[model samples]
Target: MNAAVLALLLCLASAATYATAAVAQERLARREATAEGGNRSLLRTGAWWASAGLNAAAALLHAAALRYGPLTLVQPLGALTLVAAVPMGARAAGRRVASGEWRGTLLTLAGLGLLLLPASGPAPEETLSFSQVLVVAAASALAIGVLASRRAARSGLRHAAASGLASAVASALTQTVAVSAGRGGELLSARVIGVALLVLTFAMGGLLLSQTAYQGGLGAPLAVVNIVNPLAAAAIGIALLGERLQGGPAGVALAAAGALAAARGVLLLTRTAAQGAAPLPQARARDRSDLVGVKPAPAPESATVS
Candidate 1:
């Protein structure tokens, strides 16, 4: 089998695992209040640990995918996590999959397909220079800082986008580390250490933001993450890594359109999930004494009493 095919499969599997983890983690976030207890209780839960394990596995697969595929190709495939999550989430919530959900899922998949079809070729494996590394670190810190600042006031969409971008930066750093490793560079080198620190900061920040983003339900936040992570990584790949698509302007246009379509699907799915998660209106309890202003039966008097 070709390495590229294997890489694509690995990405798909990673997406599946990630989808499961997202569902599990979202449930944990809903069950345990992070602000009140700082996720201590949540950390102890089996579900939390299970999700963590799945995510770890997915990360390994994602790294492997990056090793064999271009960033633009592999990253966008992560959106499948959102597609997989909808049905899984529906099952967990004891709801049937709606038509709109299916439509959104199909659109997302089709867009992903279009995006993949025109990829010119695998990107050349390139290592970041010292200057590039510094730039990435500085940019990552600033972006994450800006995103973190809004966490207290922002809605779920913003939180998700922030976390997704953080994760993307981390992904880009990871790719650089991989390139270094592939070129026989020492892992303990200064360059590796600097990048590793940036990766750790962004990754942890993204994780926490994602947990808080659950207030709006899994679909919205997960969709944002799916959309943002790839786009961010692809941008970094093009700008920093000198990656390019083969088909020139036309290819770029198609890719952009596909991305927009996928985004639309994600938005639709988010809205659908939000609607599903909404609680049914409850019946108000009536006070026992009022009885809707109806008078109670008069007390019985002695028999034959006037």
Candidate 2:
């Protein structure tokens, strides 16, 4: 098969790998929550390490895929990891996912599929020249990530938002590195032994932040983050590197469809969350009455989203 075809397959495999890792992460969170009042450690429980491992595997797969595919396909496909994690989390918690979640997941995948359809041709193998673009992109991505991570504790969804932004910035830098690096360079960096280290460090930081965000708000935030990351990277590609998208309006239309699908998925997740939020005030009011022993309440009901 051609390079584009190989890239497309790699992209899909990367998505699947990411999704599996996310399922593991969601399960770990549910387990952590269950052990909340008990003695536990992230290390002993193997949660952090497992997450790191799966994520590393995914990153390796993604980087290889990137060598074969376009950024637009690879990054968007990775977002599915978040979408897949929600139901997995619910399952781990022994709760059934709401119908809305199922709908949302389907919508997200459908949209992503639109964006991943192979670009026709053997794929560009342009020889690249080392430039300052990668370094500048790195600095900018790090700055933005630090800014966004400050919001993680506010709400679960905020976590997703932060992760998405961080991932986008990191991807932007990564793309710059991949596209700008000279194929002719004998060394990883032109001058230093640690240049690859910086690249690896930024990439890992992005992954860790994104993982945290996914744990807090697995769906909506990731959806938004996933969508926004590529858009930003693509924008960078267009403006800085003179990258041109193949196919005129048709390709764009397909991508728009994917964006819309992902958007619908976000709407479903947020609406379910909103619906769940509605009962909280009423519950609080009842709790106040119960404090005075006024209302003889039934035992605390085990409520789960269905």
Candidate 3:
């Protein structure tokens, strides 16, 4: 097979692995409490570790895909993780996949394909210098700090959005590191070490935030991550890596439209999140009418996007 075909297959596999990891991590988060060390306990859980392993595998495959394909082609395919997650999540929960979900998945994939189809071609290899890497790192750090400050104690969307943004910057940093590594320079060099540290920081932050996002709900958090990761990575590629997308102004317009369509599809899928998917609200007042000593009522339920 040609390199292009191989790259496509790798991208798909990476997406599938990422989907599996997301499902596993989200389930872990949904069932666990935050007081259990704010996602740190996940390190001890067998399921969480297995999911992390899958994520590691996916990252390796993603890097390989990048080696053979343009950023525009590879990053857009990452959106497929969301498409894959819906069915997998439904099946795991012993629920039937909704028809609207199927439609949404198709729409998301179709729009992503349209957005990326014109971007066909192999990307030229480029290595970033230490200064460039430092700049990227500083920018990502600033974004993460801002997101962290804005996160509320009870808002799942805030947590998830923060996580998604962190993950997006991490993705870009990963690309930069990968490109630098491909140059086969001294591994212990300051440049490589600096970039690697940034990658680790954002990646871990993203992972923690993503798990927290499950506290808010499944589909919405996942949707935000899926949307932001690729867009951020692609933007970095265009801005820093000097990769040119096709069709110039027209391509930009098409990408914007396609992004909107994809976001809509994600919204539709959010409607399919399991009943009571979000975190429970604060407990309510006890009912005085109970014969036995009144017990506080449970918090109200959360609804997925309607």
Candidate 4:
């Protein structure tokens, strides 16, 4: 098979693995308070641990994709995790997704697809100082991730912010790797240094953040962290590195539209949590008692939405 085909397959596999992990991690997070002595629930159930494993698999698969595809192509495709996570949540729990959930999912995927399509290249690749760029990016990422971690020491939101920041840096670096590998026409060269730095700085940071985020809330943090990562990378690719699409202004405009649609979808999904939107089958009349994936128990059923 060709590199592009290989890259596509890797991207899909990574999405599936990451989605599965997200589902499992959410279950563990819901049980956090109830985990007596603050012991790990997933230690026996292996939910969090399994999620970590799946996340690792995803990072590796993503690396393989960069080896063969353009960061421009591979970076946008990371959005597939969003597509993967929701349906997987539905299927694993033997639950029916509500119309709102379905609508949110579709809108997200539609907008992301538009924003993330691979632009066939017609322009010469640009090059810059390898070590200096990598060093700067790495130093910046470390500072941000560390500061976020420290500031968010006791807050779930802080941890989420830290994790999300790291994840985004990792994703951008992953794409940078693919670009670097391609530039040198060899995996190890001066051109490849940027890619290596991207991995060292961002991907490494992502791993640490993933652990913390998965410990908190699965759906919200996963969605936030994973989504932010690629958006950051794609933005940097276009703006900082002068990456261009072959189809000119129309392509750029369409890409912008797609991003807006996807962002709208994300905002709607976020409101589900923020505005006290009912989650899953509890809101649905036919929900079963034996829901497979776990989440925090509902506030009193009698509790009124503000």
Highest lDDT model number: 1
State the displacement of the C-alpha of residue 78, model 2, in Å, after optimal TM-score superposition.
2.4
Q: Model 4 residue 240 lDDT?
A: 57
TM-score of each: 0.82, 0.70, 0.80, 0.70
lDDT of 1 at 17: 94
What ranges in model 1 sit over 4 Å off? 33-40, 151-153, 277-306
- lDDT string for model 1 (61-171, tens) is 887888778787888888888778878865655456677788778777677666765563563488677688778768866776676575554677777888888888878
* Stretch of 10 with least lDDT, candidate 3: 282-291
Candidate 3 off by > 4 Å: 33-38, 150-155, 186-188, 274-306
Instruction: Name the top TM-score candidate.
Output: 1
Across 1-306, the per-residue lDDT of candidate 4 in tens digits comes to: 877778789989888887777676655554554455333444555655666778778888887776666556766676677677766765554454445555666776777677666453322244335654566476656656565656546644445556656665565565555555666665677566646666666655565555455454344455556456556655555655676555678777877887787666756655544544344454332223323444546758776533
Candidate 3 lDDT over 1-306, as tens digits, reads: 776888789989998998998888766775565334556666766777898788778877887887777676787888778778877876655455678677767777777776785566665376567777677667776776666564443556556667767766666666666666667765667877887787778777887778777765456667767766767777777787777778888888888888888788767766655433322222112212121246756544663322
User: What is the alpha-carbon lDDT for the whole of candidate 4?
Assistant: 0.60
Position 8, candidate 4: lDDT:
85
In model 3, the clashing pairs are none
TM-score order of candidates, top first: 1, 3, 2, 4
List, in order, the clash count of every candidate structure.
Answer: 0, 1, 0, 2
The Cα local distance difference test for each model comes to: 0.73, 0.57, 0.70, 0.60
Q: What is the lDDT of residue 161 in candidate 3?
A: 65
